[model samples]
Target: MSEKKFTKIDCKELKLGMRFSAPVFFDDGENMFLGEEKAVKNYHINAIQRWKIDYLLTYGHLVTDGKTAAPDSIYMLEDLEEVEEA
Candidate 1:
């Protein structure tokens, strides 16, 4: 497994088909996600549903999957940063 840290919201490092696990705060409280995008809008809804995610504050790109579909966005948390350590 590889990880990359991002100091910016929705760091461009996120890509399609790549899995993300972020712990966030929601109106109901807090939750986490370990999912990948299946389409353009899936990530938006997925993030909002899992936590109080606002796409405007986040920005992520598609991960290159040489053989399958790509994802949309990658939500960012306060103290979290992606690390690329394989």
Candidate 2:
């Protein structure tokens, strides 16, 4: 990554399940596999003046019987790494 900008995620544009990757770990240490973007607005509002994460990413899909659920709100800082074309 070449100095990519960390922009705030728009809750409205965000859907229930979307995939994203970051560099930091979520609150839960053991469960670092992935997380979703559940309740974006609630997460955003509650995140202010707290942990202070610049950006957020949806881990993956939520296990549901039929009804769709929002992703996890655990926002982790993503370190940009530059990959050269081979």
Candidate 3:
């Protein structure tokens, strides 16, 4: 059997204007939310926070402007700083 692992996205990383690289599912892991078609807005974050949802499930990463942020992209502080400088 193949395993379909899901990535968890903390609500904290969600910000206004972040467009997902792919669709994201709700915590239920069934219902879909952020489709790549649209960028995130204030109300989306508001609703997530109001519902006390700390995280979301997805198979992809977040895209902002022209940058794609993978969940696994977390690395050393120096690397992050280097990215910021670029």
Find the candidate with the highest lDDT and give its number.
3
Where in model 2 is the C-alpha error above 4 Å? 1-4, 23-86
Candidate 2 lDDT, tens digit per residue, 1-86? Answer: 67433334443444444334432223333323233323334444355326554444333332344544333422221212222322
Candidate 1 residue 34 Cα shift, in angstroms, is 2.4
TM-score for each prediction? 0.24, 0.24, 0.65
Best candidate, TM-score? 3
The TM-score of predicted model 2 comes to 0.24
lDDT-based ranking, best first?
3, 2, 1
Which of the two, 2 or 3, has more lDDT? Answer: 3
Model 1, span 1-86: residue lDDT tens: 87433223342333434432233222223222333333324564565546654332212334345555432333333114454332
Candidate 3 — what's its lDDT? 0.74
Q: Which candidate model has the greater lDDT, 1 or 3?
A: 3
TM-score of 1: 0.24
lDDT of each: 0.36, 0.37, 0.74
